[model samples]
Target chain A: MKKIKVFTNGLIKENPVLVLVLGTCPTLAMSVSVINAIAMGLAATAVLICSNAVISLLRKVIPDTVRIPCYIVVIAGFVTLVQMLMEAYLPDLYDMLGVYLALIVVNCIILGRAEMFANKHNVFESALDGLGMGFGFTLALLLMATVREVLGNASFAGMSIGFLQDYKIPILTAPPGGFLVFGCMIALVAYLTRGKAPIKKSFDCEGCPSAAFCRKEGKACGTAETEAK
Target chain B: METYKLLLKIIMTSVLVNNYVLNKFLGICPFLGVSKKIDQASGMGAAVIFVMLLATAATWPIQTYLLEPNGMGYLQTIVFILVIAALVQFVEIVLKKFLPSLHGSLGVYLPLITTNCAVLGVTINNITDGYNFLQSMVSSLGCGLGFLLAMVIFAGVRERMEEADPPKAFKGIPITLVAASIVSMAFYGFGGFVTSLFGE
Candidate 1:
């Protein structure tokens, strides 16, 4: 039904990392290994679901003027909760994620969902949307991590593949590799989606989460077209 | 003299070797979103530099004195973000009230900076790197300038990309990201320069 559509929307149609290009920083940073990517994805998903439900419940209580700050505080609270639990239980993953675990505070995906969906939807719907978006984000990360780990390190998960290990592309494990793999995935998604992957246009602010608050409207040429559509 | 040399090395390493965008992948949002034109790129760059410098300055002491001593390091993420959010809001208001013209140009980008990982990254990095106050300031300034440098260069390339045709699927962001990979590859050359300079 409509609920299912909302839940599945983030998996492919509106994939946060590929289509929306939200939260690219952590996506690139943590996708070097399959395990790291999965851990990061699950962590982010937990935060997203928790924050979304809470934000939805408090949507009416929080004033419009201070909603952004309120949502950030809520999201940060969840992130800290995750960080602590991970540090205590999964110390290795905790260290591996490093600064990025904390950087989740600024991950636009969480805040973006809070503003775009959670603040307006009911708790159940918001939770579903968050779950969908989080899964989409995690899926994209898994895809990138798979390619990167297989080629860069010649491994799957953490295990080494016999022959491939001898011919690993070191660059795939580096910064440039992250960008290359990410770029190609975006192209692949665009191709599969029939050139409707929300690629960068002249007026990128149109779909940007901050677009509503932006004041320089006349500058972006696509703003008018986007608005019309 | 030795301290000055170390500071110089920090600046060099941050600007080129450990660039926030190209190397660390921080702030790729604005790096891709606003780099279509030279002017807009520089405007965004300038705004980032201003905000980053302020955010780092504010967060460093808070981390050193407030967070660490109290064993509240886990609160670093929440605290730093709130600081940045408040700083951006304060800057926006001040700009609107006093410097309306400057605000008009940079105002739109200010809100975006609040969630910019680079701002938060630099603050967190300053602490984790164990830099003292002066070193943190230099590193923050260097990181900001490096971001500006990358944005300006990427802007020029994107301008040229407008004319060159690519495959339909690779036309917009995908092609741009590929180009960024090349840029990142070029930046990789500077990786060993810092260590060599220090002869370490």
Candidate 2:
């Protein structure tokens, strides 16, 4: 039951892209297409699940001072493994994802999960959390990409919506378009989730025990993890 | 001559014609988050240029020699990201220990570069675009400067917008988005200029 809450939290409440706002770099770069978004999301999810499971299992053994670097090395190892498999099998998707794939090592989603959940939680719970967040991130990105690609490129998925029926807003597909879409989504989420979220001040609690607790301390606090290295 | 043309194309495309920030939206986090003031923007820009240039230089060798030759191409994402993070850490330490002034100004933005899509984007672009080491270096340099130029200009504009009267909804980020759109359109004008100079 508690694991279920953890899972659902990632889908909506602690969403990596929309709610938590973690991992914006890939959220913006690879979100050019729904397919890319889904592919990238799944790839990250696979890496996240494996990394989380491994980290959770090895959490006690890892030294304290070297925790962050250790997490990075573990995450990087999995990411490299994924990169090799993708190149061999999903070469097209690999090409499309470009550097954003390699950029996943620093993706706050994987590392954030490693630190916040996996390092502390049991393997089963960590895997569930990773799966949930991965899917949630994929969903958020798909939502964004749907709007961006359909409006920006006048297509849903790879197929064109049709010539007369489909109208591409060129701006929505461009750089400025990305900003606009991101802002609108953020505003929409804030509006939808308003009043439910408690607002608080101060966010330097780097040593805080509970992320969800600290996150609830402020509205923008958890979102700033999007910017966390 | 062919190599020279490719280099020139890369420089122009990355710097003006298809800028990573203004045109590609690769590094909007820093572009929006860190670009509050021109001076700081310039500093961030310089730091990004240095990092991007260095990252591309380093990744090229790793990709070509270590990954491709050894059949470890699958490790590109993992290796590249680890390299980038380590590189950022190395740069942070060097700046702190050697160039204190730069370290101070570039303090906050240094770690952020680890996740900067633009840095990773250029490194990946270098390989995808088939740029040899020299060409990738030049391209990264051009992209970095282009990013700096966009950030500084936008920062200046945003700084001025603080004093301007605007509606409440479109005041903060909405207005900024509109501003970015206009700026993007303005950048499109440079495309024509590049075409005229280089001849498509």
Candidate 3:
């Protein structure tokens, strides 16, 4: 029961997507199709879970000041490992993902989890956190992909719907469609969750992994807020 | 003259056609995060352009002579990211020591660039596109300028959003994202047009 809470936390209450919004790049790019979305999500999840566990195991040994670099190295190692494995076996998905597969090294979700969860928790728990967040990320991607694919491409998982084929909005599958679907999905989640989830301020409130650094660097957000008002 | 046109085409393509932000979605975090103010957005954009060029210059040769020659290509991901991270740090330290005034404006953005997918994306993309050293550097410049172009344009759009009111649910990031969608759609106009400008 205790384990369940840790794993489920990332699903909705604190979804890495609709809520935290850590990895908007991959979330926006690879969600053009259901298959690509699942491929990207699971791939990032694999890297996330491995990096979380490894970082958890070495949490105590790594010095606090240099931990960011340490986490980056570990995460990059896992991303490469996953990249090569995928390239060798899943060449099609590899080609589909392009630079994004390699770009996962800098993904805020993997590194953010390492910093926020893994370093403080036990290995098992950290792994579970990774899993939960991974699921949340995948689920969000799946939702966005469904909207984009069905409406934009008039297909579901590469299958054509005869009736909808003639009425497809091709723009929904393009770059603008990616952003529009993501925006609406997030708005839907916001509407559904209402007062339950933490209120999100525009631009990198809690979701941004670099929020801490940006704040430390003389409060870029602070000044921006002042100007916005 | 022919080489110049080719390079010119590459620059125009990256800037307008294959924009890193609107089309490719490389640096959406900073795009949405820091673009509230034009000054801040341009500062970040300028810093990104600097780092993107440096990262490509550093990574292209590493991939060509170091990784490809030794048949250690698998190490590209790890080595490139580390080199970028270390380079950003080295740059920040040197700027702080040697050019404090410049660092004051740009230093805040250097650390952010390390994690920015745009920097990493442009570097890896140059290699994947089979660009030689000069071509790689040019594309990097083009990509960085494209990023800056997107940031500046979005910053202006966002400033307008500050005055406009929207629904309850679409208030924050949602509305901004929707606005971004519109802006992205507008960028589509540049497609196919670049090719026509410089005959095949």
Among all candidates shown, the one with the greatest DockQ: 3
- The reply for model 3, stretches above 4 Å from the true place, is A205-207, A211-229
Q: Across residues A110-170, which tens digit of lDDT does each residue of candidate 2 receive?
A: 8778877898899999999999999999998899899999888888888888872455688
| Worst ten in a row by lDDT for model 3 chain B | B104-113
lDDT of every model, 2 decimals: 0.87, 0.75, 0.88
Clashing pairs in 3: none
Once model 2 is optimally superposed onto the true structure by TM-score, how far is the C-alpha of residue B170 displaced, in angstroms?
7.4
Descending-TM-score candidate ranking = 3, 1, 2
Residue B9 Cα positional deviation in candidate 3, in Å, after optimal superposition: 0.8
TM-scores of all candidate predictions against the true structure: 0.93, 0.83, 0.96
Model 3 error, position A61 (Å): 0.9
Per-residue lDDT of A72 in model 2:
72
Deviating ranges (above 4 Å) for candidate 1: A196-203, A206-209, A215-229
Worst 10 contiguous positions by lDDT, candidate 2 chain A: A198-207
Give TM-score values for chain A, per-prediction: 0.90, 0.85, 0.93
